[model samples]
Target: MKIRPAVRRRSIRDRRDPLLTALTGLMLLYTLLPLAWLVINASKTQEGLMDSFGLWFAGDFALFENIATTFTYDGGVFTRWLLNTLLYVVLGAGGATLLAALGGYGLAKFDFPGKKAVFAIVIGAVAVPGTALAVPTFLMFSQLGLTNTPLAIIIPSLVSPFGLYLMWTFAADAVPREVLESARVDGAREFQTFFRIALPLLAPGTVTVLLFNVVATWNNYFLPLIMLKDPAWYPLTLGLDAWNKQAGTAGGEAVFHLVITGSLLTIVPLIAAFLLLQRYWQSGLTAGSVKE
Candidate 1:
């Protein structure tokens, strides 16, 4: 037999994409620059914050002292804000994810009347900026006596158009038609099929939606600013803003270091959540990419 001509495989360098590499580098710089500043300034004293370079340290290290002040100031209000933020994240994101999952799965798997209308409404709602709805939401809740309460935040957050859309696409792509039919043939109830069969395959998309909702609720300021009047109901975003404002008034109680440190502290949990859940996200993204 005649020998086949040698096939030349592209080397890694030959496969490299210049545009993607440049975009990745730009994104890295954009995301990390502020974080680098936060880390540097958070370790400095107030004087250092005022006098030193933003990306470098000054004369003294005050990280521990600043952390201590951050948690202990005003009877440990920062701790309270942290706890409040956690509560909001758990309830709001959890509810949003649950609702999105159920609604998305139903839309994808079931036949129902008004389905097209529902889809149209959801898409339209997505186009409407949430900030634009803040006034209407505040009014509606005010009439219902839900303003100034955690429910005010949770209720609004539970309705996420983007999350619904994401889960709908994911559910359609991830849960195969035959698997769902097999579940029905096995006499599994609808809810049982969803919770047992579809939910597992939906994990990556669920995590993505959960992460986004968590970040949104965690960083929420405008809604809470308008809805909540009580300090006890204030999330970290509001608490931090209040602190920053107080720091600026004449003869104001300024703890710039504490502010910097607290802001840094605010981000750690979200970062941890992303790191822990990244594998699931990657797996989910590739799960439907190929047909086996």
Candidate 2:
């Protein structure tokens, strides 16, 4: 039996699709190749890292040894940096998300004087890069004696205009005015209605806002570099930069492996956090995609 022309064309298309898919897979691997090298290099000793292949693992797996040295070196200052990062992540991101929620809810639900002006200011703020304000922020914190303190990082991280915009956009669609009206009809107080009714609906938005803030604060380097002089107060990003600098200098090869290992470890928490919270973000994205 001979195959039909349509069937042969369909088979050709199907075969071409696999080739296209393989090309995409290869591109993804190329993109991720550097990270793979980081992981492989992190597991090797200084000599192994210098002498061995970049893509393959070393014969002696020194991951645990590198981790120990990373933590204990400089009197376990890396642990302090890790703690500082966690504090910044929780306080900065959490506070920013809360404020974004309140601001967004207010913008969405209330009709008030100067609302347009307020929104315009927010949009303008969003356009301004965070780095542009770092110098002024440092001066302000310096006057207040907040430089070198965790507040120096957390305070700035809490003022994310992008997060506010995202929440505002989400609230405009996800939260229904009829629901708020019904709550008012039942004699629910404004705060009560917001906490009970609006907040639950805003969960997905809140999660997304939190995730963005968390990642930004975690990867923050420039602000901390300008604000903090004390190594003890360093976040992981600043600490890693310091390590990278030292690794390039003489007699720093012993700590080179530790730096690579620490860099790998630093990103693990962020990956875990996103993996855990992604469902809420995914749902929030699709929540208002369809209308009744």
Q: Which tens-of-lDDT digit does each residue in 6-49 have in candidate 1?
A: 22234444456776798899999999999999999999888888
Q: In lDDT terms, which candidate is top?
A: 2
lDDT (C-alpha, whole model) for all candidates = 0.88, 0.90
Residue-level lDDT of model 2, residues 121-234, one tens digit each, is 999999999888988998999999999888998888889898888888889988889999999999999999999999999999999888898899999999999998999889
TM-score, per-candidate, Cα-based: 0.90, 0.90
- Cα lDDT of model 2 overall? 0.90
Please report how far candidate 1 places residue 283 from its true position, in Å: 3.7
What residue runs in model 2 are displaced by over 4 Å at the alpha carbon? 1-23, 287-292
Q: How big is the positional error of residue 57 in model 2, measured in Å on the Cα after superposition?
A: 0.8
Number of colliding residue pairs in each model: 0, 0
